[model samples]
Target: MFMKWKFFDKIPVEGGVSYQDLAASVGAQGEIVSRMGQMLVSTGTLLQPKPGSVAHSRLSLRYKTGNSNGSAFAMLYDDFQPVFAKLPGFFGKYGPNLPVGKTNIPITFASGADGKLTPWEVFAQQGTEHIEQFGLAMQAMTGYLWPHTGAYDFTWVGKYAATNPNRTLIIDVGGSFGHSLRANLVKYPNIPPGRCAVEDREEMIPSITKAHANDPVMENVQKVAADFHKEQPVKGALIYFIRRCLHDYDDNDCVNILKILADSLPEDEPQARVLINEHIMTDPPDREVAAIDIIMMTWASLERTVQQLEKLADRAGLVVIKVHRAGGSSLGVLECKKASRS
Candidate 1:
């Protein structure tokens, strides 16, 4: 059910279906394919041709690696066109309001969970297989969310940290390979060593450390093998950062992860902030944001809207103090604070 609409990139030699037609046959609305298709085209990542005639419209979109049937978008289109031609009323039958090939509806992962697989447990169990697919998904996602730098409102954060470079602690929790750190470092020269730290899985430390060996500012940048879901290592860092990490799990998982994060901080810091980098879906349903919601659903994750994120923060014993829309899209820079004891 989940795989029915996963984007496929290749053409089938024999299926005789086109991507567009398959999209039509499955009762998928034009907006879904158009949005996803336009995204691929906009990034110059891939090209897709709309079939000239209904006869040549059907295609197969084989999403997986070993699919013997027509799987590519082109193939999917080929497969789709014929079905539509044969049954002229398919589009009218399902219509845009119905769920034709909608990807995420939450029911999918629950089925897996019924089999006793928690989301991350599923990831940990599948290990490399899941990671590889997830990584590819991330790559495609990054492209769609172009100008990724704008996603975090890093400019504002850097400017603020620059005011007290020596005292500020910029900890990128779950920061993978120091990429975001470097991005911030390059933008904000006022920040210095011992100020920024990156914490991630133990397995990633060596390579990340080696990569930063020559970085003078990062020399004091502590890199630790830590889990944000269990506990944070630092006492009361000025900022605890998480980028694209929370959306990988369900609501309960996020609550537990945030609880661990909140507990790790000290009670008496002048100011402590928890920054989450993620997309906050639009309420009325924008094409791109809705598309990602489906993707997250398939991966056993959720991308909350601004109100929902704030609510999640409150549940975790923190308050959403501020939100910076660095770009118009779903991504936002959320700053949270511990509930005031007073």
Candidate 2:
């Protein structure tokens, strides 16, 4: 809390600020902020360059407020205390196993919406801020922190777009605020915005529309109000891209979602694609991957491996063609095609 309130990228690197002053800046009690600063200092997250004063430590520099520290943005996902507290009770009601679907998870139960509403629904009911925070937090995870642009080469899509200007080149399903589409436009101006589209839930469509209302970059980019759980309304697109959304669902739900895209593919073209972009955990699961996997447990979701994704694709009547991942990227694109026409 102290780190988010004060250390947000605006802290001075060489000078120490008094805890009392820092607390005053954030309108908090002095004694409490002082205590928290001392605790952070002990943990090497803050430095006592001088007595009674604190400065950003080597590790805490990234936590500066205005900066895009994905870790910091994630810590703001919500008050997770209640969520973790409900874990045992949630399991007791269900069974002692990893969660699979969207409903009745730890977060839903903690929010007092278990079996009544999904987390997204719960967030929507709370207010716009909650939903917006969740969206920005997720964007932080995939947009800035561990961006997929580096992991996979998308410039080739631009080349493809140039030749096929009128074809539906990409459809980003469940894309929030059309970030991916905007990104593609920036990278490859050859991409015809009119030929691209973003499909999301009904409630979220307004926000997407508002975001692109006056933005020239997304002028002609199409927006569709659609649900991935149901059949994909947009058909025969060159790229049916689902980015960072499947992990929100379980194996069965994921298979169903993938099947819709597979069913919508242009069989004769053979180039129509179903690309799933998400983190693919290593076989042994590295520290970061393991941590994210646990975080996903909040909603009974998971960070899957390529092999696991292959199984899910096969179940969905899609065949995994290849997984594209560059070195140092935390996410990958699972290139897929329809398993069979019949």
Candidate 3:
């Protein structure tokens, strides 16, 4: 039903679309369309004011054309679902241990050319539309939470930028589309122009540029293409901000990513910080956090607790200075700095 009619894309948000009209547009039989429409209505995705016509529900509106939430749904349904289907067999063979090296479930289930690619590589290979959709989905996922400003104060960084003549103020490593940076710019407009930079894979630069082209927030934001697994190129940045990026890798990779960032900080500059924005799993975990933990497991990544994060930081020669939790949400800003050599 999702693929056939592009129901979410084609249906008008303000009014109902008839089942017969939807079926004709998709070239599907009327009876089948009716059945699927009824099923969707039953699932609360659509509302049936009458027998043959369906209207958008609040839930269904999210998947409308040009909506990031819809893009996210497409990424999960079209891309991740196949990997999920292979999980039972994957666990049967690999014993449910976190996949490492080349034992990726997505690759295992993927056909032909994609069978050999890592999840990141696979996304890169799919071209621009796929990458943009994935990014939009990520933004949609975090839209419910408090903005990044609410979680981490940028005033200090702005002040630091004002005083520090030569130093980079912020480097958003693995930051896709500069959403967090854009938000920061909106919140703290005084942050020095040309002091902030965003790094992602080479494929993502153009899209990032286009995404923030019109916004004054991104006017001075530098877009650099660098792999996060390697040493971060821009050095001595006062703040290296990583939001929702580390949770995509396993523990070892997470340690390495942090270590590289940690190594880049100037030893004399104690104020330099690495801000990690992600979900900190609760003691009695919330259902949303628990559910996402399982989803992240598909890629062998995970959401970390405060203890887990601390350990990860310690392993990377960094110390967790504070964990700022947003009120009424599972998100946290884990502030870390280089461990003092005592």
lDDT agreement with native, every candidate: 0.59, 0.77, 0.80
List the candidate 2 regions with Cα displacement exceeding 4 Å: 1-81, 93-95, 141-145, 213-216
Off by over 4 Å in 1: 1-148, 151-168, 213-220
Count of steric clashes across candidates, in order: 28, 5, 0
Ranking by lDDT: 3, 2, 1
* Weakest lDDT window of 10 consecutive positions for candidate 2: 66-75
- Against the true structure, candidate 3 has what lDDT? 0.80
- Candidate 3 residue lDDT tens string, 73-167: 78878777777777777777667677665444544444333237677766776778888888888877555653556888888777777777788
lDDT of 2: 0.77
How well is each residue in 186-260 modelled by candidate 1, as lDDT tens digits? 766656646778897775577668757987766668888987767677756777888778876767778877877
For lDDT, candidate 1 versus 3, the one ahead is 3
Candidate 1 vs candidate 3, TM-score winner = 3
